[model samples]
Target: MNPDKTLAMVPADTLVVLDFETTGLSPNMGDRAIEIGAVKLERGQVIDRFSQLMNPGFRVSRFIEDYTGISNAMLAEAPSCAEVMSQFAQFIDGCNLVAHNASFDKRFLDAELDYIGSGYSGEFVCSLLVARRLYPEAPSHKLGELVAYKNLTHDGVFHRALADSEMTAQLWLAMLADTQKPQLSFAQIHKLSKTPKAKVPLYLSTL
Candidate 1:
């Protein structure tokens, strides 16, 4: 199937909003995901959750520990990366995925899943990219900024996987609500996300 048709097959509520706290940037540079969090939503309501901390087989730097509050000592007793990712892969199976800056999460996800001999088939939606197109006047498109910009409720915490994922989910639903087109399919929204900001209205009008 074409990409749009594949995305259209997924129901809005079935999107898996996810986040990863990693050892560092660029999974290709040997950075590994130290924690994974995801929420399954249906019709803008959260239906399920998955959260886990993984032992990356190396000590996380003090900076990372301070940033994420996930210490190496804490991860010492956690499951191995392979173990947690195996379960995560199953949890997100056959579901569209969403992340704030999806490229970051997508890189780690693909790398980690590749390490586990697994992969997801569903398309990924970048809430950040979509927000940029949908709300050009907003001061910033950062997840937290968008949260505040849209007056979306959040726990006031950032960086940890689950909290960020939940916030991203809310931001995503808010973006969809702002679109004012409830009838638009996921594929349609996905297409709009890739359009230049100036052309979004024109594309939506065509829809």
Candidate 2:
């Protein structure tokens, strides 16, 4: 779906907070997503979730396994990336997406979707970029660090898809409140994230 046609129907707060635990850094270099996790948020509440481990048809590097706690044993019985993403495509239907470092997720999402001849209609907002504008003084904008800085609830899990997506969801909500700009449209926030930090206040004020 074209973002223009759907943006009007989709509210910024009604979105899927998504995360992908992958085999390595670049999908272009043949990396693949080992797991996909997401939470559907409607009006500030988590209404649904999607989680799955996808076998990439190869063993994950020891560093990747250690970093994400997703081992070869875990991927051995999982479905293929195409199968999992087909289901995920439905899960995120007609909803905008959010992620901590959205560029990374977007790359994998596009590449995986390309393999299935599918794609997302909704645009994505980067919580990391939004947080940079909203919490410039925070110790760091990394998901875990921002969660700690903002006092968002968590189970002390990181790198795993579901845990990270949940933290990102909480952080997104917090930033919404911090904006103090009620009922702002999704496009406004999207633009704000891309705006320079020093100009964020001014950009939002004009919106």
Candidate 3:
């Protein structure tokens, strides 16, 4: 996979929204990322895309195969996790990242990168956490629910990495649209996502 060299070339200003479909919930229990997806955003627009499925060296559960539509047969034809992550490490290097339910993705990212002796330098912002503060009136903050709540474009697909990342990118851009700012620094975006739901209005006033 040819990574976008510009991502590392302009590290400080780039935002990459990412998502991963894994074998299970916890990396500590040996769950591995089967697929990774991401879209690079520039000035609130998607500028580049990435998606890859990796072989985890073992078969996933029947349930996971059904849920993600990734099977042992498919994984056998894909590159190994270490091989795919090496490219992914370059793909995301030196760029701030956003993910829905980021804690889960971060676990796998950190773990896989560790195995490959590679890692990213950028910080992470959780779209899930940010949605709670930005759309407090929404019935749910899940990627799928928020996609529906905010009328984000979706192809009726979930549990797949690329589609979820695309939808999350829409959800993220919608939140930025709420800011009404032409550009926000990485620090500002990080701060906004971390702001309390009640004080979000006051904080945006400062922005």
The models' CA-based lDDT, in order, is 0.89, 0.90, 0.85
Order of models, best lDDT first: 2, 1, 3
Order of the predicted models by TM-score, top scorer first: 2, 1, 3
Say which candidate scores most in lDDT.
2
**What is candidate 2's CA lDDT for residue 65?**
86
Quality of model 2 by C-alpha lDDT: 0.90
Separate clash counts for every candidate? 3, 0, 0
For model 1, the superposed segments whose C-alpha errors exceed 4 Å read: 1-7
Candidate 1 lDDT, tens digit per residue, 1-207? 675467676655558999999999998889999999999998778899999999999998899999999998899999999999999999988788889899999999999999989998788889999999999999999998999999988888899999999999988888888887777677777777799999998887886
Better of 1 and 2 by TM-score: 2
Off by over 4 Å in 3: 1-13
| lDDT score for residue 207 of model 3 | 68
Lowest lDDT sum, 10 consecutive residues, model 1, at 4-13
Error of 1 at 196 (Å): 0.7
Shift in Å, residue 66, candidate 2: 0.8
